[model samples]
Target: MLREQGSAIRNTLDSVLSLSNQKAYPVWESVNSFALIKAAEAGLGITILPENLLLDSLLHKKLRLIELDGIDMENKMLAILHKDKNITQPLKIILDNISNVL
Candidate 1:
């Protein structure tokens, strides 16, 4: 499968693979989504991508959309901070609200 490396999605996929005890030997890996999609459409291999990214490509009769059962397709946003930084109650509340929406 084609994997977009160095992404949160890839990290999530790695977690899923670890939990499932499955290993993937990808023939292609890159950060370019367009190239990855093209490769998939060209029959290179399967790739996991957000539905919103597949809108135009799905219109092609030759391309098929396959859902990954039990997998969340939503993009997860992560916030990182320094170790010395303290999260105040207001900041925590705001972060919690934002996280809940995601």
Candidate 2:
């Protein structure tokens, strides 16, 4: 399934799955994470999501993690800022907090 119409996830899947030569699977696309989880719980289909997002469901036994042997399913978070932009006090504080937590 897909999230938002122009999701980077779609491109990611295309690259990972060699989508050009493969037949398309039926998709249940949505922009909402809750909807996606509910659909998976109902056995509609499996989805790829960040481990953090699946913690609750996994703890409750509502979802299972299936590790694929050859898939590079790493997710990363990046913070970008323009070199010319000033780092305000508030922004620095926020960034520091996030850095500490991470």
Candidate 3:
């Protein structure tokens, strides 16, 4: 996955323009932190995000974050679910997986 850099991989027209020595488009402008994470999740590109954002069940299997040679931004993720819904056996398995991974 790519991060919010001027010369990273992106699929927008502005990103294309920037490659041709033209001005950048605001919609294609890259931001730091969660903006990169959100964009990656949306399939715009892959990225290397901090470990902390993957703490919740919603992200456990939905994405895969990679680590490189010397990165030091590991973190945790936290989430909350409804209390009234009956916890099913399959869901319990998913929760167990989340706990084991994070």
Clashing pairs in 3: 1-46, 1-47, 2-46, 52-75, 52-76, 55-77
Query: Which numbered prediction scores highest in TM-score against the true structure?
Result: 2
- Cα lDDT tens digits, model 2, 1-102, are 555545665555656667446533637777777788778878889876666667889999999989878777554557799999899999999999878754
lDDT of 1 by residue, 1-102 (tens): 655656766766777777879865678787877888898889888887666567788987546898778866455578888889999999899989988755
Ten residues in sequence with the least summed lDDT for candidate 1: 1-10
Candidate 3 lDDT, tens digit per residue, 22-86?
84334344556567666766877665444565445235666665655442343345556797978
Whole-model lDDT for model 2 versus the true structure? 0.72
TM-score of each: 0.64, 0.73, 0.33
- Candidate 3 Cα outliers beyond 4 Å, as residue runs: 1-29, 69-102
Q: Ten residues in a row with the worst lDDT in model 2?
A: 17-26
Best by lDDT: 1
In model 3, which range of ten residues has the least summed lDDT? 6-15
